[model samples]
Target: MASSSAPSSAASTAETFPAGTPAAAQIFTTVLSQGPLTRLELARRAGLSAAAVTKAVRPLIEAGYLVEDADTEARPALGRPANLVRVDGGRALFLGLKLTGDQVFGVLTDLRCRTLLARHAPLSDRVPKAVLASTAEMVRELLTEADGYGVRVVGLGIAVSGDVDRAEGVVRYSPFLEWREVPLAELATAVTGLPATVDNDVRALTVAEQWFGAGVGLSDFAVVTVGAGVGCGLVVHGEVVAGAHGVAGEIGHVTVDPNGPPCHCGNRGCVEAIAADPAILARIREAGGAEADSIDEAVALARAGDAHAREAYSRAGEAIGRGIATVANLLGPERVVISGEGLAAYDLFADQIRSAFAAAAFGSAARCELETRPLPFEEWARGAAATAIQSFITEPNRP
Candidate 1:
């Protein structure tokens, strides 16, 4: 069996993960997501015998990946109390990046998804060449910072806002980045000399949520991100759903009105047509409430109680709500998490979203909880890191 101990190489510092064995991986994953578990409880949850649990944990414990905490008060009346096992966050490191139209946001995180440092730089050019250059610079900067930790950077994950083929490490298409069929993993590896994984930003965020945030322990949930372009990530049966074509949960393009507005996708009245940042800005401009140059200006106007700006946001909310309802009705997710830059205007649209969702949902679908989580750009980068961590553990031999 592969040892759970991490490699000592400065470029691959993550725990060895012992993922070759299904039981070891399952036990570690359980603890990583819902840990501080007693040996007996772990055995029960993992559907393994007490002996198997002990056998699996020993290597992890020896590697400093899993730590045992004594529980004196929990001592059983008949026998010794079981100690709890938990992941040691500081033992490994990973890097993540979120590639936007005009900027690349990056972060270095420990195994626990905690951000250690963040860096951002503008993309003066959007072409693949320019973007790759910027990404290499940012990765170099983060790698320098990692040097101080005395741990290797195990993986690099890049999240873009578009159709991403994670398994193939390809960017099928990214509207914002104007990229098509970019072999990002190969390019990134050549530049940074680190293993790379690419994924849709929202899907990457879903991974982070699955492992460390709101969706933890939930088998089915949806993460709806509203910003530059509306995005959704679906988790079904305890796994992130990447459709056969690498596109799933695309709530942004869900048509809300055939006569609404023209979307860049050559469609009429897409949810994105009415609610994305550009659409919101265009509506505010047409309404003549403010001389807004961007979404920020429009948000400022709404915050100042401009009726036209408020109405625009309300309309966006309604469209978003309708789209979310579609997701809930079709998938019946346990929860729908709303996030992204647009949450800055959440107060303006929260009511409309709730009301529209209530009106459109069918029966118990309305009971699907709607939650708002305000996460910074670094969180997206952390999501990328989570993907890298996943690949490192599950497909170490992937090239």
Candidate 2:
């Protein structure tokens, strides 16, 4: 799970992503996400003329970022077989890191966001300097692995659970880590010598889902994560919502019961206060004088038919469900993805979650599909890589 070896000196230079113009970047993204498309289909999906797509793709293809090939499997009944275009996954590499309170999860991914390697380092300290050293060491290990593929690692992305200013590459606040005003991106870049991007962990996960996982091709959806802390990531009108102050979709802080429990954000009965892993454990301990050292232990106690443990899980589920309904009512998303390490105990609370969601959802909002996905910390790291890929292709258009 970890290594004590110090990081070597950083790489001097890296390759650049080829998409420069917004139109070109948009076209590349279309192919990267909804890829292996014919020129006609790419043009149609991108809402651009064939000539425009061709012009945009030319530079990308020349740069080895895009590849064209015959779709023998989908060879038409008509005269000619159409060539499908797709991103070249081996063209460039990126490093992504998910920083948690106790550990750092990292991954090496290609241009198309395919994970090639993964590593983690235990975090005994939460200070910026310590975390940065651990992060740099992890990136060094990953970059060494990348050397095998004969490709340059172009960027590094760090996903932290907090209010992150992606545009500014700063972590404004991180309650879990007790950090404030940390210039994470600059520090990371200085350590690794790669362009670094910092973003909210859940929002970074949403970006990965939008590009490659459950939320692909869906314009309106929400990703609600339950675990040590409850978090939500929202996508509306095909863009992740960052809000005016770099914080949004914070359903975890929504007050589900005005008198339930105290939240770290200074609110009573907030969803996270009742539904987060620590909260469930605390409730179980309070109800019957039982002690669960970890969420897994709490799950096992509930599964063993302990009444207090079961009741605690039920309460957590209800709080989470209400928070989800709030999101549905406000956004009317087409789907909501419920995920995180907490899903390991989903069976214990599944019914309560559904029942509460059904009762609280407003009108047509109740019609929204609810999906449960189990994504480990590694996937969250992959999400961080996706953010790096996004910045790489669209940096020119970024404000």
Candidate 3:
């Protein structure tokens, strides 16, 4: 295992990844996610020849970044057998952070994206300066922790909500953070002395899913998060779709009802207007079934068998289902992974979501599987780390 306390210069060295060889990167990435593969399997997965796989694995093994494990079963009685190749998780370390409106959550992760430690601090203010200060403090604390492991921290990933331009690391507009046009990557790099990658939180999460979670091996999938807001991340043609304007899968703004409640986006009947946490809370209050001021209160009331609260959740689920159906209709994704904080109330409206989706789906579109997985805040931070990994590998040639 590489020591986390390695010199800063060593950390910088890891960032100098070899380029101009797509096959090498692809082979390494394949092993990183689904490793312990023989050379033949690596070639098959990476669509490369055995010679190409051998060439790619050579540098990685020489750098101590990948290891070959002997498989006793694969070894013949006397002859040698091919070894399985896998990435060395302990070879490097990374920092990932998720920036919410009121808090900054951070985590230290290994190359396998395993969380080693997590830290969080509340945000007293959402101003760019305040957020940057809080972020710097958080990074400092994590870096100190990294020092004990004797491994270099090579990169930092910051995940924020809203219109984030990952290519440029600019947050064009974030309603929750009340930020606009913030050059977050530059600011963060300046403060932390590490290369930084900033991305939309949902898209970052989607990348994590594509590499290591439910969306693995799937060319087309959608992740719909229901929580403080409704957000969607889409993958088409084996690539995350960021759209032309850096915003593509804003399913929260998908219109479900033309005459429904108004949204913060100044629209009516958006999915978020009906299904987000605040929307649920507002609906509960309007129904007068409970004196709830938040989603927790509403969930409690519904759990306690309050009919009005139950009705509110049902309506929200219907809206969410409709929004998901819109994504399915347009993209024809093979599967949709439903997640987010609002899944805490999944039982309250799961049926409604399924039924509404089934009803709204046109033709075979309903065949798209909808699976729910609850992702905690730490996972979001991990998604940020994945973005950092992506940048470390792809930055040199990114358009």
Candidate number achieving the greatest lDDT relative to the actual structure:
2
Candidate 3 on 1-399: residue-level lDDT in tens? 113322343245335555348777788788877887999898998888899888878888887888999877788777787688988899888899999999999999988888999999998899998898888888878888888888888889999999999888899999999999999998888777778899999999999998888888888999999999999999998799999998899999999999989999999999999999998888887888768877888999999999989998999999999999999999999999999999998999999999999999999899999999999898999999988877766663442
Alpha-carbon runs more than 4 Å astray in model 3: 1-14, 76-78, 396-399
How displaced is residue 386 in candidate 3, in Å? 0.9
lDDT of 2 by residue, 15-75 (tens): 5667767889999999999998999999999899999999999999999999999888887
Model 1, TM vs. native: 0.94
Could you tell me how far off, in angstroms, the CA of residue 296 lies in candidate 1 after the best superposition?
A: 1.5
- TM per candidate: 0.94, 0.95, 0.94
> For residues 1-399, could you state the per-residue lDDT of candidate 1 as single tens digits?
022112224465333565557787788888888888998899998889999999989988887878999788788888777788999888888899999889899999987778999999999899988888888888878887888898778788999989999988999899988899999988887777778999999999999999899999899999999988899999998999999998899999999999998999999999999999999989888887778898888888889988988889999999999999999999999999999998988998999999999999999999999999999898999999999888876774665
- Could you tell me which residue pairs clash in candidate 1? none
lDDT of each: 0.88, 0.89, 0.88
Candidate 1 local Cα displacement, residue 213, angstroms: 0.3
Query: After superposing candidate 1, which stretches have Cα over 4 Å from the reference?
Result: 1-9, 13-16
* Model 3 score (lDDT): 0.88
lDDT of 3 at 243: 96
